[model samples]
Target: MTVQYKFPDNFWWGSAASATQMEGAAHEGGKGENIWDHWYKREPNRFFDGVGPETTSDFYYRYKEDIQRMKEIGHNSFRFSISWARLIPGGEGEVNQEAVNFYNDVINELLKYDIEPFVNLYHFDMPKEQQDKGGFENRDVVALFAEYAKQCFDLFGDRVKMWFTFNEPIVPVEGGYLYDFHYPNIVDAQKAFQVAYHTMLASALAISHFRKLDIKGQIGIILNLTPSYPRSQHPADLKAAHRADLFFNRSFLDPAVLGEFPTELIELLKEYEHLPAYKEEDLTVIKENTVDILGVNYYQPRRVKAKDHVPNPDSPFMPDWFFDNYEMPGRKMNPYRGWEIYEKGIYDIMINLKNNYGNIPSFISENGMGVQDEHRFLKDGRIEDDYRINFIKGHLTWLHKAIEEGCHTKGYHLWTFMDNWSWMNAYKNRYGFYSVNLETQERTAKKSAYWFKEVAENNGF
Candidate 1:
């Protein structure tokens, strides 16, 4: 029996890309340096094969051709972020007219093809000046970000109807503060907590600004929600998984949608003396300005178990102090990205949002597989990425089930539109419908692109 899987009416069909990852001409068009630019200059060896953001996919010069390709692939919508440093060089002060013109042209081009533009404000490309001023650790940066948001609304709000305050807000905290992957790396739990808090507060402030502007559009935050699974039914294991969820997912999810931090998370932070220095006014802002929409980016599930060994009391406080990652036996895996493949995690996330977060309108903002040595899958001048096709189908099947069960999911956007430069990993893992030739900057559609075009045309598989 061939059972058709159909999405709801007006389900957005497209892919996402970030300015830092897509736009080349890193120093062109009167753009200011961002953390990526600074970090690459300081430690070029840190990035994969010494490839930095200086010359990514050249989206700055190729957006017109890219938009045309998007139209041909049946995309009714597209999502991309504006480079803060590029738009408002130095992260404050007067806007660069060239950057403004570039983005305006991109938005207009998307609209010309009947494609809705989902614009995101921030995507981990912090201005170097802001980073020097303590980045998110300093409360002043919050206001600065709000000002930038207001500028964006004033400039492009009429054409760009869907606005996102931040994409994966917790990622910077995790990568820059907890882990040492991102620039200005510091493994301080206290700083990480402060960064997370300020990001949530900044999101609220942006939402507040958006409402004041009276824009006829939806405003929201994009969160990468990883459903936590316990190793066993033991109380300790269950507690470990729950705490992991609180630390990673709900830390940003709660404030963005529900306008409050989880009680357990607050108590845990307080106990560890890791609570961020926040003013009463910031809390009020968060409480009053919940998101109008939610962008759920699910890539994997977190499997955790209770910590077996007590940490040294003198060591710095960390989320792993309460839980440890558990590797489930016989788990499906994406070896390239080194993440577990759990398709049902998408459905679980949707159900969680529906049941706990007022059933807020949401969408799969980023979901796709990254494969190393993708060229090996090429055949007859086209990449025969059947695995990628199956991956999307698996996740979409679960997403469709969630909708059947009454989850308010509005769309599904793959992690990216085309193969572009990643942060540190560079081009090691390809996760795009169309593969790009880094040497020539030419884009060739993969087998999955044709399959996805048909799926979008049919509204489902």
Candidate 2:
């Protein structure tokens, strides 16, 4: 077969899974309770099917087998997050020796298969103990996070070359402070801005620590960027999209890549009295410690339109106050996940980075189709997920174009490797190359896994 969309040589091909999402030893391995464990224990009904993080794919004990499977599937790199609580129980002093051995074994196993380990420091699993101290809201907790990051670097930086300070930093702010979907749920824009600010500050501090360590690796922060597209070229619609972009994308992107916050975002926050309380010294740290790389996770695009009505003065200041989500008529939709399937969004994001953010080194860190009841596509013994194969190909075609057009795009990693317990949604939406039997813990390779193997081996599809 002729290769049509060949990627650059040595491109990374694998998947990403967080500790809380895939490691079933949530309470074992000397692991301390994280906010997820605490939240699930308190509000089990809030999770789908009453499932919690403890029911993950058992990667904690099965990582050796998983690494072998990754080698078979032609993975050159795999991204995984180190459980903060597991490493240092309660996210504080007294490092767990057992946890250190487990991670060292994981890194060694991956290297044995010639797979690069892209380690992420945080993935929304704030230790319950730290949350008691107001989490990132307290500047001392921010210092604690930086200290945790330093420990991770000191422990794993020898083998792990790509380090991410945090994965999707804006997500905790949105889920916990704004929308109330995650743990410690609160709906105050004031606190939301504070969490966002503190999180960015934490990342900068981590990077500062990494540079001081003189580790022979690059460090970055992973951001889930959804390009904000306007409903039309009308100035009002454009303005709405701009605001959404400022609040969602640029809020984190500018700080990580450009070493500063967007001017408009700061001005808007000040206008609404929603600016986060911060020290002047923190700004200098953020400005001086920009990232060396960027990981872009694109699942969908945000279609925005101008707000149709004037906001009441009594209403709280929210992002929705300036814009409304526009459902573009006839937009391609992922029926299973209810997200837009705009493949071009990947290209658009890359171009935006190239034009605006210095074309920093980057990769598609997470992108895949998640379907509910994926067993509906099962044929014989395996899931015949042609939809997933098409989804990846569509995105990669655009990613290839981006690379060809002078964007420094490096690789593509799916959202996951096997069916695992997701937060709140649980296993309702399966986004994996292998469909895992939750009852038996059996991982059956889906059709996409084989197709992905060939694509990875050939450097294209």
Q: lDDT of all predictions, in order shown?
A: 0.94, 0.94
TM agreement with the true structure for every prediction: 0.99, 0.99
lDDT of 1 at 459: 93
Candidate 2 residue-pair clash tally = 0
- Model 1: weakest 10-residue lDDT segment is 1-10
Give per-residue CA lDDT, model 2, range 1-461, as digits (tens). Answer: 47999899889999999999998888898999999999999999999999999969999999999999998998999999999999999999999999999999999999999999999999999999999999998888999999999999999899999999999998999999988899799888999899999999999999999999999999999999999999999999999999999999999999999989999999999998889999999899999999999999999999999999988888767899989999999999999999999999999999999999999999999998999998888889889999999999999999999999999999999988988788899999999888888899989999999999999999998
Angstrom error at residue 34, model 2:
0.4
Cα lDDT tens digits, model 1, 26-45, are 99999999999999999999
